[model samples]
Target: MFAVLELGGPNLYDYYVNQEIYSSENKYEIVANIARAAAIALNELHQRAVIHLDIKAENFVIALQENQIDLKVDPFSFKLIDFNTSVLGTDHVKANTASITKIIKAPEIRKKSKNYVNQKVDVWAFGIMIYGLLYSKLNEFNELNVNVMSDKSRYSRLDSELNYYRSNPSNTNLDIIINVFTIKKF
Candidate 1:
């Protein structure tokens, strides 16, 4: 069955890429709010035994206000969409790596292990999403370092960087969000 939904404003990726719209004085706060919103959404879904297999910036849209783009950063102003790949269960499921982006794929998914997917996959994607939001660019897997490396090695290095950032919080709102994302399980 299909349900009709309202067309929302530009997605996080598009909104972020537009420098003019993203040049707010409280950029960090805005990003923090967005991150929180996405986390909350994911948490709610997890609570309902749903796993959003595809979690990325493009799947989140900024809520519009009277046909205008809203940049106020209300935690509820952002909406998570694109649930075509979601599954409604709380167990390790078969890997469907084709639907997940390599940049945000969890280690288990990247390894193509059978029945290796669980809610934690969403957590991994959430952390990567926060990282992209904080850095203002969604880095490609190959772009993580100058030298070419296997996906496994690149992911290991990325995980180390995330741990480093988590340990070295700068006291910013975004840093707090990153800390939570990095340490959060399930």
Candidate 2:
């Protein structure tokens, strides 16, 4: 027997960007909640020894019921999609560049490191997603330029790249920024 899955709502990219649902005041809360959900989802996958190589705003869908009013207060859930790139276990060798999105790919992927890329790649990509939700500028931050830097320069670029997010007006809530970055994967 086979089961079918249905996704009724827009992808997170459309929900956040096209819909313009986040305001300066509530943006932090909404993005944090969404990030928290994504983290939990990633943790669940990691626990099962699965690595979702494609973790991006576009790959997540927000589910809603029919005629759902007050979407802000509605109990919606995030559903991750596009598992074509997912691996059964972290022990797999050779990253599938064909399936990986350039922007959210981790540092190891960018560096093309032969070392086993563990679950931390998901965490790193999720971190980038958090930043994207905050500033609505994933394109700018996810550009491949940083991927070409030397070890020391690449790490340096990481600092400046994040600093660029800090200086944006969309991140007025410093506490939210701090909290997102402070979250440790235990």
Q: Which model scores highest in TM-score?
A: 1
State the C-alpha lDDT per candidate.
Answer: 0.71, 0.68
CA deviation > 4 Å runs, candidate 2: 1-4, 22-24, 65-76, 90-94, 113-115, 139-159, 163-174, 177-186
**Model 2, position 96: C-alpha lDDT score:** 67
Off by over 4 Å in 1: 1-5, 19-24, 65-76, 139-150, 173-175, 178-186
What's the C-alpha lDDT at position 75 in model 1? 47
Model 2 lDDT tens row, 37-102: 667667777888888888888877776776764355344477778888777776544456444766
lDDT of 1 by residue, 69-184 (tens): 54554544667788877877877766556656666777777766344578988888887887777755463532663456677787787888778877876677445665545755
Q: What is the lDDT of residue 41 in candidate 2?
A: 65
TM-scores vs. true structure, each candidate = 0.73, 0.70
Per-model C-alpha RMSD: 5.1, 5.4
RMSD of 1: 5.1
What value does the lDDT take at residue 76 in candidate 1?
A: 47
Q: How far is candidate 2 from the true structure (C-alpha RMSD, Å)?
A: 5.4
Clashes of each: 0, 0
